[model samples]
Target: MMFLVITVISTFVLSNESSRIPFLNGDNFSDWKDKILLTLGCMYLDLALYVDEPPEPTVKSSIAEKSSYDKWKRSNRLSLMLIKSHISQSIRGSIPPSDKIKNYMRTIEEQFVSSNKALASTLMNKLSGMKHNNSKSVREHIIEMRDIAARLKSLGIEIF
Candidate 1:
């Protein structure tokens, strides 16, 4: 439902939306996913937390029960809109157009996010070998480390 609102509002505001709206580019899927999550947080959406799909109503279901089904469908539409609006054209072109948010999110995750095991191993190596060289100030080193930590945290891989 929120995505519906975002999309409607965006229609007016978006011309070269992808260019003007700052988001994760296709160059680094992991980075893009992390930034998008934070952006969602500001809007009170938690993509990280699991949300089970609403159960489909049966033929004998009451009117109110059927209404819940409609809401579920609407919610997924909103989710897809959010995902579509933020990605680069290069990435967007590859996405199979779908109404189900789960499918849209899953497809992107599988293709771009890569295997978490590999990402975690790579990040762990970076963390283990972290060093502060004399060429840069201590502040720069700390800031760089923070960036790494944030990335790790965003990907659900804890390095601490």
Candidate 2:
């Protein structure tokens, strides 16, 4: 019972908000991806994004090779944890738990990083038709329109 309590406490303490970079969430993946890369790059662990997905035990692997694999696996796990920490709770289930950081990131990119033409067109129409209402300042309205253009541009549909 004592060990169980300790384990639970330690897990909570170690996995809490203090360890995360910031909230990236579901709506701002482009900026969030860049932020995540920058954060991990500063730590010199950004290469974990390209590392092999899972570490496998070699039947006749040399000590050096095995050690190298283990090191990469640890970094990969760190990358995965960081990604998981920043993922918005609303879209958390999109990325399943996996050992390979490359595949995990790939899956996330495919699922949430798309630049659909339909979405871009909708944004363009909305931008052109946007009006400033009494509740919002002109600054707020312009920022919202600029954000839509930015999103459209990010999707390769520039309308500047």
Candidate 3:
């Protein structure tokens, strides 16, 4: 039917938008998390991130309660799928599984904290050792340096 075709097309377009987020390999969790949050926010799919899951609806439940539960369930399911999809298989294997988006995200944050320190030190060393070389244009060299600094900033190092 026309409705089913329209639904499938819309879903495809929306999913393509999420492909802008990079895979969460071990070294890129902070950047990946930032992109994930931004993408979810832009799509209005971040309800599960900010809210607890709603209680299940019963026959006696009010319409408002049923609606809230439905909305939360959809948000939770989709957000989990999006987050899991962007993580690399190697890193994904280490994560403790959880159906609850909030709990899963908390675990992910914890998993990355130690690695972030390692990443920060690696970036710091690179920044310290970088010198102006004639090999690349000044613009390119500076742009590369700035990109490193931005990545460092995302990891909580303020290099400005």
Query: How much lDDT does each candidate structure score?
Result: 0.65, 0.71, 0.89
Question: What are the runs in model 1 whose C-alpha is more than 4 Å off?
Answer: 1-62, 115-131
Per-residue lDDT for 9-88 in model 1, tens only? 65543343323445546435666666555544444343322455657899999988787667666556655666688877
Once fitted onto the true fold, the runs of candidate 3 whose alpha carbons sit more than 4 angstroms away are 1-13, 132-141
What shift in Å separates residue 78 of candidate 1 from its native position after superposition? 2.8
lDDT of 2 by residue, 88-112 (tens): 7867775676777788778877776
Candidate 3, residues 41-154, lDDT tens digits: the string is: 776678999998889999999999999999888889989999999998988899999998999999999988998999899999999999987999999999999999998988
Candidate 1: pairs in clash:
none
Stretch of 10 with least lDDT, candidate 2: 13-22
- Please rank every candidate by lDDT, starting with the best: 3, 2, 1
Evaluate residue 43 in candidate 2 and report its C-alpha lDDT on the 0 to 100 scale.
55
- Roughly what TM-score does model 2 have, to 2 decimal places? 0.68
Report the alpha-carbon TM-score of model 1 versus the true structure: 0.53
How high is each candidate's TM-score? 0.53, 0.68, 0.83
Report the C-alpha displacement of residue 17, candidate 1, in angstroms: 16
RMSD of each: 6.3, 6.2, 2.7
Candidate 3 global lDDT: 0.89
At residue 72, give the lDDT of candidate 3: 89
Clashes of 1: 0
Candidate 3, residue 68: how far the Cα is off, in Å: 0.8
